[model samples]
Target: MLIFLDYFLLFFHIALTAFNALGWAFERTRKAHLILILLTLASWTVLSPYFGWGYCPFTDWHWQVKRALGEGPLPGSFIKYCLDGCTGWDSDPVTVTYYTAVIGVVVFLLSCGVNWRAWRKSHHTQSSEIA
Candidate 1:
């Protein structure tokens, strides 16, 4: 059961990371995606600093699972950890945070722009139809 929980958290972490980074490409999922992004930003920016500035609850939870299962030290970010595992690139936590923040902001802005354009286009179409 503990092993299963560990893997589940790992996969869940990966999915959420990817969704935050790329989910904006899908029109149908953008609304929920943006909300999740906002929640993530708030947690990282406004929450208590016990876990540090860019603390991720999911990562903290996963670390608990690892500790319970007697696993070794966990990585800073899931994506960076995976990259290190696959490509053997030793990246520091600070670099991981920098890359993650940049990517997150870019993806978020792109998502908002896409949603805004769609909203404007629909509004214009409706106004034209009424005239």
Candidate 2:
């Protein structure tokens, strides 16, 4: 149940980021676009690795969360269990990285879409005045 909940939250957060980025892209300057690009990368790292749930059986920070909730530290064996889920010896690191890159790319493309929409709208308004 906890596992399901954790992944659910992770997906939802990513979705929200995509949505917010789209909205902001509408009115951002070039600098803002750069900032958004960097942020999307940062989020990918955090959400996909030790800090996030990207490739581990348990998220890298799951132990911390469990500890903070008065559950105490997870047993070493349990930690291994979670890590195994995310990165088993049989798992291909290349594959994992590919998935991570894909996520980042998807967000980046969405940002571009927002910017294009805004651009087109502005272009339309300007052209209408010449007609």
Candidate 3:
């Protein structure tokens, strides 16, 4: 069960990370993307005081499972873990964190811009019709 959960979380977290990065590109997912990205940022920043910076609940849960399975010490960054696992390159955690942060901020801003434009366009259309 724990092994299954570990694999499930690995897949789910990767899928979620991909979505958080690219979901805004699709019109149907823009709002959800914005919300998710904001929530991610909040987790990293707003929840940092208690959980420490760059905290992710999913990662925490996964790490717990890993510890239960007797895995050795893990990197602080999940992105680094994925990269190292997938590419066989031991990435620097600080560098991974920096890139992760920059990418997150970029995606968040892009999501906001696209969502705002969509909302404004719809609002304008409604106003024009009402007028």
Top-scoring candidate (TM-score): 3
Name the runs in model 3 displaced over 4 angstroms.
Answer: none
What are the lDDT figures for the candidates, one per model? Answer: 0.83, 0.53, 0.95
Q: Give me the runs in candidate 1 sitting further than 4 Å from their true place.
A: none
Best by lDDT: 3
lDDT of 2 by residue, 7-126 (tens): 564565445444534544455453466465666566556555554433333333555455555654443323243335567544444564565567557657766766678778889999
Write the number of the candidate with greater lDDT, choosing between 1 and 2: 1
lDDT of 1 by residue, 65-92 (tens): 8889887777767667778878899888
- Tens-place lDDT per residue, model 3, 15-123, is 9999999999999999999999999999999999999889999999999999999996998778999999999998989889999999999999999999999999999
Worst 10 residues of 3 by lDDT: 72-81
Error at 127, model 2, angstroms: 4.7
**Candidate 1 deviates by what RMSD?**
1.6
How many residue pairs collide in each prediction?
Answer: 0, 4, 0
Error of 1 at 47 (Å): 1.7
- What alpha-carbon RMSD in Å does predicted model 3 have with respect to the real structure? 0.6
Point out where model 2 deviates above 4 Å.
Answer: 1-38, 43-63, 67-94
> Which stretch of 10 consecutive residues in model 1 shows the poorest summed lDDT?
46-55
TM-score of each: 0.89, 0.39, 0.98
Positional deviation of residue 40's Cα in model 1 after best superposition, in angstroms: 1.5
